[model samples]
Every structure is written in C-alpha cells, then in structure tokens.
Target: MTFSAVSPDEIAQPKPELRIGFLLMNHFTLMQVAGLVESLRFAADESFSSRQIFCQWEWMTCDNQPVTASCGLPVSPTAPLDFNQHWDYLVLAGGLLEETRNPPAWLLDAVREIHARNIPIITLCSGAFIVGNAGLLDGKRCAIHFTTRDEFRQRFPKAIPVIDKTYIKDGGIISCPGGTAIDLAADLIRKHCGEMRAEKGLQYLLVDNGKSRSTKKATGEAATLLYDNPAVRKVIDFMRHHLDSPLPLSEVAEFSALTVRQLNQLFIKNTGYTAAVYWRRMRLEHARKLMSDTDSSIHAIATTCGFSDASHLVDWFRKQYGETPGSFRKRRRDVEKLVKP
Candidate 1:
C-alpha cells in the first residue's frame, strides 16, 4: 500500500509558538532527552526543514555547569535557570542515579516559581522524584519508570504513582516513564500543531503508530494484548494471563461476553484472525520470548508455554519459524557470540 504524499499547502504552518524548557540533571538518560527533543524538532518545521517556527526548546542548568548523561556523555547547558521567558512546559530530564542526585535549592525554587505561574511541569523518567520532592506532584496522578515506582510511592505518599502507563497528564503536571518521551512529544505536537504534523514527526522518526498511556504495562512489556474494544481486550487479557494452561475457545468467548461465533467475528473484524489463531500466535510469541531469554529445555519450555509435549512444540515452532526449537536456539547463540565484543 502506498501512502499519500503531503503537499506544500497541506503542510501546517507553525502558529502560536510553544516554548519548552529542559532541566537536565546529572547522569540523565540520553534516550529520554533525545526522544523528546528530536520529536519536537521534527514537528517544529514542515517536512524535513529544520526551522523552529512552531516549537522552541532551551536546555538549562541551575549553576550553568555541564552535565554528564548516564552513558558518560557530557552536555553543556545553554543558559542558567531563569523564568523570565514564557514557557509552555518545563520538563525535568531525570538521571539514572536519581536516588543519589538531589535537586538543589535553586532548582526547587525554580520549580515552585514555574508552578506558581501556571506553567505545566513535565517529568521524564526519574525526574518525577525532583518534582515530587518540590511538592509539585502532591495529590496528582503521575507516571514513573517501573523500576522506581515503589521508591517513588514511599518517598512521596501524597502523589499517586501509576506504573502501568507511559505518561499521565493530570491538570498541569505531566509525568512520563523513560524511553516513551517520543509518544509524549507526539501527543503535544498533535494537540498544538496538528494531527498531520504529529504523524509527520513520528514518520520522520520511524516510529510505528503511537500508543496511549492506558495501554502501557508496568513491566515494560509491550501491551500487544490490548485491543480497542473492551470485550476484545478482556479476552486477550484472559488468554495472556492463562498462557501457562491454554483455555478453550468457548471459555475465552464466555470471558469476553460473547458467543463463540460472535468472538470469531469480532476477532476477524478487528485483527483479521479468528480467536484460535490469535491465541496460537500469542502462545508462539511467549514461547519465542522464553527461547530467547531463558535456558529452558524444549520439554520444559513446551509445558510452561502450554504445549502438550516436546514434539508438539517442535512441530509448531518449525511450521512458524521454519526451524526446529533446537536449531533456532543454536542460531541465536551463534549470532550473540559473533556480535559480542
């Protein structure tokens, strides 16, 4: 299928500029900062022209000192912290060693002053801790990386922390788990710029369709089981939870509040697969994950993934991947060894 090209007139002209400020903490994750920045940069201009007509961003530090990322790359700040300019959003780009790095007094003051002016505060990754510490996150729903959920909850009891979400926009405070800053930037661009611009930004970045905050999971597992329909989502969730013991189609249909025929029709209509086929694909996906991440024997892996026996697994694995389980494992190991430094 071919996608329609966006014409010059179809391209949206940047209007009502959105200014964003980034507060980079020491040892911040580069992926988070780059994802947000690059997505916004794509949305700021039409197509690939690198113009800052729509969105403008500034990188700042409390003391105007250079900050090192978690990956050991150092970045110099463009300016010292100042609230003189009107900023649509103030993002706290958090670091890997969040527990050790405390927000200095000046940073906390800046946060409070920005909050007082009704500017939205966005926390990327462990940056939630900084806003939480500044009392900006009190009594607000927030999102944080799953690794930091428990500690964040204990540290800030008043703030409601949600782990099973990519991002949350509660009033003026927007919180996002790390590595999903691209989605957050796309959402902002969609709201401010236009859907076309957001689509262009994601296309330029080579990101697939964006995901909503509700579809995310705490373990950072892809929410592939989630479907747009509630009934379909319920069935998918049931199938995923019971992957260790395969459930019959009749029972799966009942859980989805649909008859077997209705379930089949729904599955085919939405996902182009019958319920049984979809369940089999999910099981195969689980088996592939086990094969790649664990050292389980074929028999053990088969049973754990709801296969009847080793032969049954081998038959299906070969049919799906064009290789037996043993051969696939060996090939994967060889590739890993060759790529290792």
Candidate 2:
C-alpha cells in the first residue's frame, strides 16, 4: 500500500481547547463583553495572530437577533441557539439593575433549558439576576454587584448574593462582577490551555495580575480581585512598576493615603495576603517570568526582580515553586525544544 507522508507541522492541527458561546442579553455592558471576547481572542491565537485555534468563541442569540448594549452598540448574533451543539460554557453578560429587570420571557426559558442540559453557565454583572429570576440560582451562592443586592434579595429570597468576591462558582453557575470577565476568561484559558497562554493575554492587556487566579492555591471559597478597590489596586501597581527597586510597605501606604495598618488590612481582605507577603509573591512571579522568557543570569534576574542577590531569589523561588530557578528554566526550555520542528 502506498501512502503520502504528513509533516509534523501539518499534524499539529487546530484543535481548540475551549468552545465558549456568548449569549448576550438586551442592554448588555459593551466594555465587559469586549474585554472578555478580546481576552479569549488573544488566547485563541499564537502571538496575537488572531486565529481561533486555541479557543473558539461565538456570539449566539435565540433567533440570530441583534442585541443592543447599554453603550448603544448593537451586536448581531453569529448563530441561533442550538442546545445540541456542545459548548464548554455559555456566558451571559447583561447590564445594570434597570436593564436586568423584566428580562424577556424567552431569555428566562433559554437559561432554564440550558440548565436542564447540564451545560455550565457564566454570569457577568447583573446577569446574575437573569439566572436568579429563572430560579436557577436558588439555594446557591453567587457574586453580584452591591448596587443590586437589595433588589436581588427581595426578588429571589433563596439565592444568596455574595458581593465581596469578584466571582464565585457554586456547582455549575459561575458569577462575576462587572468588568471582571477578562479575569474569568484568562482563568478559563489557564484551565484548558496553560498558564503561559493565559499570561500572554493578561500581559498584552496591561493587566498587572501579579497573583493570577490560576496560579494561586485553591481555597474552599472563591478567589478575589482588586477591581472594586482603587486604593489597593494603586498599591499593587506601584509594586509591579518598581519590581527592580523594592519599597517599604509604609512608603507604599503613604502613597495610597492610608496608614500602614490600614493598608495591610486592605491587602489581606482583597488579596488574601498581607502587603509584605503579597509583595514578595509578586517579586517571585516576576522572577519566574524572567526565567521562562529571558536568558539573563541568575544574579542579573535576581537583582532585576528586586531580590537582594541570587541566593535570596533562589531561597524564595524554591520555597514557593518547590524548584530552583535553574531547574525550572531547564524544564521549560526542554519542553519548548521538543515542540519545535
């Protein structure tokens, strides 16, 4: 029998790791949708080539109808809703309290049918109320914004609203606050693809994300973010920018207009870590990225990441990652070599 040979490059076909369907609600938040879609888009491609190889995302509606957003931008659906079509997750991104109230009866039925099919659903911002209205969020913990908590409670008494967390996944329903969809997308990419691919998107988006959700040790409860707290975000940004020159917590606290104790409390409450601890972790994350992407020596990388010296970085690196920087770099490079043609 005669057969034609297939090159390795050809064998590396485009098999997407995730198939996500976005179901937009009327008067949805355009910023949230755009951030989420762009995050997945970047993760789907290689080096921002914009190909949907790693991840596949589509905008779908009940009858291929166009949905208008709160920002006055209308998006035409790419396909009609098909329950039989397999999807990794279905995202529902709706707008404020007024927009979410009195949602179309069909939309409610659609979520009920989606729940019946055992498909996971992701709710963004006020989208929580939509699922709550359909009785899907009953007896389940969900994340919602503070503004709508009172009404959501009165509307759906059984559904417990959690406002502090950026996102929470109780069983099949994952709910996130407004504008945190990008973080959710990055996390999904990390789950199906890998950390590096997720980081690629975050890095390009200029997301500081020193303690990315995917890398953190899972607590029984949901993880947190700095989106709602400007003070903490400012401090985190300060730490990221001055990675090569470590600063005192008191100095950072002064810049944030909060006392040392107050700053530490904010950091602990938001990030699950004290300011000093979070700063150290952030430095370690930077060191790891440098080890993976650069050819700098240990001393140079240590100094660049604000470590006292090579020994100091190695000590913390081994403590956190359970491997020396040299060992980690070697393994990563070995994998890359194997994947090359």
TM-score of each: 0.57, 0.59
For candidate 1, the TM-score is: 0.57
Model 1: residue 49 alpha-carbon error in angstroms: 2.5
Worst window of 10 by summed lDDT in candidate 1 = 213-222
Clashes of 1: 0
For every candidate structure, what is the RMSD over all alpha carbons to the true structure, in angstroms? 18.4, 12.3
The CA lDDT of each predicted structure is 0.71, 0.74
How would you encode candidate 2's per-residue C-alpha lDDT over 1-341 as one tens digit per residue?
Answer: 11122234532243355788887777777777787778877776666556566677778755678877787777777667776667888888778567678778888897888877657788888888889888887667788888888988899999878887657765468888775467777777766666888888888888877655433333221233323356766787788788888777788889889899999887765454678888898888778777767899999999999999999999999987678888877666654543444
Show model 2 residue runs off by greater than 4 Å: 1-13, 209-341
Pairs of residues at least 3 apart in sequence or in different chains that clash in candidate 2: none
Prediction 1 global C-alpha lDDT? 0.71
Top model number, lDDT: 2
Report the lDDT tens digits of candidate 1 across residue range 122-172.
Answer: 888788888888887666678877888778888899987787766776535
